[model samples]
Target: MSTDTTLETPSETVSPILKSVNPATGEVIAEWPVHDADAVTAAVGRARVASAAWRELGFDGRKKALLRWVSYLVNHADELSELIRKENGKPLEDAYLELILAVEHTDWAAKHAKKHLSAKKVSPGMLLANFEAVIEERPVGVVGVIGPWNYPIYTPNGSIAYALAAGNAVVFKPSEFTTSIGNYYADAFAKANPELPSGIFSTVNGLGATGAALVASGVDKIAFTGSTATGKRIMAAAAERMTPLVLECGGKDAAIVADDADVNAAADGIAWSSFANSGQTCVGTERIYVVDELADQFVAAFKDKLKTVAPGSGDTATYGPMTMPSQVEVVRSHIADAIAKGGKAVVGGPESVRAPYIEPVVLIDVPEDSLAVTEETFGPTVTIKRVKNNDEAIALANASKYALASTVYSKSKGMEIARQLRVGMTSVNSVLGFAGVAALPFGGVGESGIGRIHGEQGLREFTRPHSIARQKFAIPGMELLSFSRKASTVKLIKQVIKLKHGRHT
Candidate 1:
């Protein structure tokens, strides 16, 4: 949930209110009270105080509370989805799809928290055979989550639900553009479980200043989803306090079309992955590298598919306008740059970038150094290049600074191609399929950001392990820990070391 202006704190502090504007019509949808540093501090303090009680509830107790919140979300999904359509400017069907993914992920986190976060016993080493070793997974207290706007519900819920299920209180600062949606999400948890403390799930609403304050608010852990640049700033700010961070950032995800691929199916899946939500998806397919053998058929099929996709404010439209206002210029510039270079637009061109709604723009044979191929174009645009072979296609796909996600559309060699991609998650024979599995960890490497926020990894992200060892009995003359140990003890240790580890190569 980031933009060029995201997380920018003003030098002169003033009461800056967030005026949520509908991107489709430039209408003022609603105004929200800004939360300053002091307000953010208070929210974190409250969450810190509630963390104790929340952790004391144990796994089963916490699971029940989480499920209750999920039910509330499921029941009021329509209302929430409607608001998402209005504020976020996504189509109603897309909004509903987002809600479904969010609730399903929340439910998975609730049901699986105990299995992933419970205390467990471990084997004692030979030297400590008389002792029992146990490891306890303890909550890291309060976590501050800075969410994204492109995925207002699903993305934040990835961190929020997992953190809550792992027995940590959460202080969430949603993207300022979707303040109401963020508040409505946090409020649902309170309404579902009246017995929980006020700070178990809370929100701090405002612009970039509010988010920056959350990082400096002394939270035990920070989970953020946005652009790579913003993530880097937060990483630096979080370092001062040695706070743990989970950053799910930007992606210039690529798709590889091998000679043995299903041309039509590959085109359809890539088209959806490229243009869905106006191509604002962090894991969206922004680049395509097709083998020369299949390049002509693939490009033709992709063009046919793009003809069915259009961006508009109408309900029946395939997709909606760009949620972030500043991103429009970024899209326009990328198109202009690609054209200025020797790239040819086969389907849509510069005229496609109409404000708010950017019609699908597909470029062929664009220079690899062009902005559309190098930087993250969070709009309805994709650059397709024909490579000599799979090796060349793989090389070009892995050249980007972003290593977030990618897709491979090879029928016979899907897995082979997918394994060669330099990304956190890769969908074989499909596009963006990794996101549908709640059990799969989601995040990235390099500029894509740090850490992960799903599956067992997500449950552990908000926790720290505490190890305990108890002695069952002590040998009278073999007390290794005693100061009065005999010289024979040293001789025995030397003999054991020679008989054990010393034998290994």
Candidate 2:
């Protein structure tokens, strides 16, 4: 991790501030005090103190409190949706969808945590037939969450809800671009449960230094969502204290269209998956592989659908602008590189990339090794490649280092093709279907991320397993090894063991 002290120091005469800007309009929406390293450490200390009482509340108490918080969010959904739209530059409908998922996960975590984490008895082996064994899941003190701007509400709640359900206090550090939304989330929960400790759910707003400080503040666990490079730096910083962390990083997801696929349905699903939220989604499809026999048909259908899709901040727009201004250049560079290397732009090209708002670009005939195909182009752009068969499509999809999410469209072999893709979750004949199902675990393999954040696995991620064993009684005639035992007893025991095992040997 970079230990550069260029950020605001404690002794500075003036405190710094973080400015939240609207990406679509390039206007400053709000300014917040930037919490420095000391502030973050203090927040963690407070949370640690509050965690004791939180754990004492037990499963039922915690569940009631979390549901109250969920009610608050539901009652004020409209106001929260508008704020999300302003901060993220996503369509209003998309913002509402994000809020809905956040609420669902919160409810799921509260309702299921006890059933999954409570103590359960296990049968003892024959050698220990008189013993009883049980296992219990315990909370891991305090947790620090460093969230991303994209899907601001839904993504972070994956950790926050589960951690709180497991009885751990949390100190959240949302992305600088969406700090206000983070404050809103923490404040709403505080208002819903006035009797709860202040640090039970807290927010610290700032840039990179604040996040780095949270990692080293001795939090029991850290849940992070962001780029792979940033995840690496966080992992290195947390290594000093050996703090366990769950990382939900980037993904260059792919979709495969089999020869027998429903071309119209596949096209519609591909368009939405590739361009929704201006292609800012971590699981968005960056690459498409279509069987050779249906490649032309799929492309034609996809282009026709793209004609109706427009990028804007209005309610009618199918998608909106890129939330981060810096991401525009990265998208432009990838598209330019692909075009410069013999790729053809079937719909839009490098020239269509405008700051904040990038018109959807569909590229075809791109080489398999191009940056657009090989890297995570987090923009409203996708590359379509023709494959000789389903096997070839599967091979191309698995070539990337990322394995977060994938999509496959086929009339008969959807499941078979989906099983071959090396990704954490796959949607057959659909895009991003696994995310809507609360029971499914979400996360990835390889560079995509480490650990899970939804369903039963997600709830357990915030807890540690504890096992207990007790002896019921001593068996009679089990003292053959004592000095007083007769030689005849030892011989009988050996003969019994031999009769049971000698035939197999």
Candidate 3:
């Protein structure tokens, strides 16, 4: 939340330019234009007009363009990764992983859109027996996407790629912190398909106000990703126009380490889940439950591995500084609350000082009511609790307000435990596995927000279902609708209902 007045970028190259700052070293990387309300409105209007023709191009042509975009991303993998790393302060490796997910999504959506969205035959029912019925996906005009700063590429691409493949033009307003990366992706598409109008996929770089403009711009739909609080506001804005929206927001995901689990593997997984990208991920593990028997072993092993990662500048580093400084304060307060409530820091404490980066801290015996345990810490901190059995682990995990995603560590009981957890997606014996599998839907319920983002749900989120029913012939029982039914016809209807609906009596 710390805003540096140092101009984000030169105004000539791009108006309303954003300053790209490197969180790890407090250096301004670069700046690009900050688009205004009028510009964003124009972008959505352009998409609306462009979609009229784009939709007619049908599935095959759109798929070709998306596939070409994939090739563009793959050829410039290193370049894109660098752009992501510079704009958002994640490690280069993590940035590469994000790009990889984007590539996979592009290919998946292109290959599977027709299968998921194309017309499908359905039963016409007795009332309309003479008619045929089918369900098809229709492009919902213009789709406005407001992406988050974390995982800027993959998360936004989840909606963008799918919307494009479904034949809808997109107006993307990336988070102010990661506008440059968003611009880079949009510009690549413009280069790949010069015939596509400026609005087929446009990027407007600005703050919250610009996003609000898009929501108010009469776009057919809005796909947004960010904090749960902000998501509520977006939902309200979309409600103003009765616009349909898909919100993929925050989560307080948990991980369970059963007695049968491999302690080393669990420790390694927890380290990655909690500290990767400095714990900015929406599905990152915030709370961990271990069987009482293995509680001490996990704490010791986890601490040993965490000590190996030095948070600041180094060639051999596992994590970088937090992308946003305000998050550092939130992490600080959560740890303090845990300590005040009789929790012990097994590794580093608030006393441990570091500038932008915080030492990976592990809290033990934290009260379930404590903020660190109940809310999303979104930092390199995790609360470890001892559970008597798997049932207790499941209960504790489900007690949170957010039910986005979760992980399980066991050999035989992994799938069973995963099924018992109240989450949209679970990674059995791994962390964040469902997201890597493009076929599975990725989203949440309850406070974690509604709607799906990946897989078939992802493709359909941007499209409307268009059902077509054609009559083959008149029904033999036309008397039913004509009010001319006879006693024998009523008797026949009763007999058929009994035979079809009731058990053969």
Candidate 4:
């Protein structure tokens, strides 16, 4: 493990309460105190107070402040990316990309929040036309953002940046694995805007308990990114308070390689999609279904790419260690289970893991019922299955309980196959492509998760729509208020409905 210890310790430490344990070396990277419940409450309270003032600034003012933040992040990308790499054990290149994308999200949210969430004129039926109609999208007040370890900055900033730009105060609780990265952002943001209350962009340090508290802390909404099981818990807790939540959870995403695909390109995309970031992405492809006609050629090419690839520790590696140590066992069990059920490791086998770093494993003939194919083996593992054609490929890809993201590889049939996949976002001839497009919505269906982050969907997710209607004039009849409604009035209403919504002669 490379420990530069480059961060300057504050003269007045907040608390030596939280500790970052390196997944590769099992060494302590940094230590800080867990914020107490009182502290959390104080932060939330301050956010509530700050929100009033912040919201009063209007959309343009808030956009300028957030733009300044984006400028800061882009200018100091290296410093932020390094912090993320050290804390989360991801390659610096990947970290740098995540950092830059996060800044993009910030800029998008700041620029688009007003257009997406502002009041607009709405139609009112003739009966209610006396008053003018409008629909307003209002801020949800305080939003608690509990981010994930993988893509730490981008994932949570999807919510944090949106919430802030939408006139809502954010209380950010980053994953413990990447808390320092979160802290660095929070501190930098504070430095940039001292007038902004500490709570408006507060950072709470702790574990799951802190997150649970935030979910139940009377916040108007909660935005969470993590495992499906944990997402369920967060949803249930939020249910008690009737607070809305955006849950971005795990996915057993898959890719399909049709007979007409560029075999080498497909292989490259598959390897990167599955093993990049040590297979720690919610949208990462965990399975591949190839048409039997091209299965052999694809597998051979994929194995060739896999041969040159290796999981290692360092700042410059293609991928890094599993951010969470416990995930190692999950990966192992999945491999073991696949092998037990007639699966063959085309390249790497069960012995791929050596402490924190797990070499990429490519398996074939894995049964559909195997744990590796069904569960989220969030490590450097990919299971390949044979299919008859595009239909079979779609079926297998949709078979998993997760439907977050998918990739379809084919020259002519790529888009057709993508449309058939059940996943929320499908990349045609590309891997993780939707995330790079700021206009696309990112989320899942089924157990993979609900609610979208990024793009226009992201800006709308943190706001609530309020529709108002004004009556221009009364209907031709007085039947709307009186108990005795004339048959003519009923006929007129039916005619109006049909004229507005139905095809006319």
Which candidate comes out best when scored by lDDT?
Answer: 1
After superposition, candidate 4 runs with Cα above 4 Å error: 1-16, 471-505
Cα lDDT tens digits for candidate 3, 1-505: 1111112221223346678787777788777766766777778888888888788888898888888888888899899888787778777888899999988988999999988898899999986788899998888889999888778889989999989989999999877777788889999888888887678898877776677777888999988887777777778878989999998877889999986999989989878988888778888888999999998898888888787875754556677777777777888999999999999988888864365788788889999999998777888888899999988999999998889999899978998898888888899888988888998888988878788887998888888888899888876655665677778888988898888989955
TM-score ranking from best to worst? 1, 2, 3, 4
What is the C-alpha lDDT profile of model 2 across 169-274, one tens digit per residue? 9999988888889999999999999998889999998877788888888899999998888888788888989999999888999999998999999999989999
The lDDT of model 2 is 0.89
Q: Against the true structure, what is each candidate's TM-score? A: 0.98, 0.94, 0.93, 0.91
lDDT at position 433, candidate 4? 87
Worst 10 residues of 3 by lDDT: 1-10
How many times do residue backbones clash in model 1? 2
With a 3 Å backbone cut-off (N, CA, C), the pairs that clash in candidate 3 are 8-19, 16-34, 17-32, 17-34
TM-score: model 4 vs. ground truth: 0.91
Q: In order, what is each prediction's RMSD in angstroms?
A: 1.3, 3.2, 3.8, 5.1
> How well is each residue in 1-505 modelled by candidate 4, as lDDT tens digits?
0011111111223343788876667778888678656667778888999899888989998998898888888888888887777788887888899988888778888888888888898666565656688988888899999888888788888888888888899999878788888888887777777776666788887776677767767889998888887788778878988999888887899999998999999999988999999988878889999999999999999998877677667645778888887788889999999999999998889889775889989999999999999998888999999999888888888988888999989999988888888888999888988988777788899987889888888888888888876556665565576778898877887898888879966
Question: Considering lDDT, which of the candidate structures 2 and 4 is the better prediction for this target?
Answer: 2
How far in Å is the alpha carbon of 62 misplaced in model 4?
Answer: 1.2
Taking the candidates one at a time, how many backbone clashes does each contain? 2, 0, 4, 15
Q: Which stretches of candidate 1 lie over 4 Å from their true place?
A: 1-4, 10-12
Deviation in angstroms for 430 in model 4?
Answer: 0.7
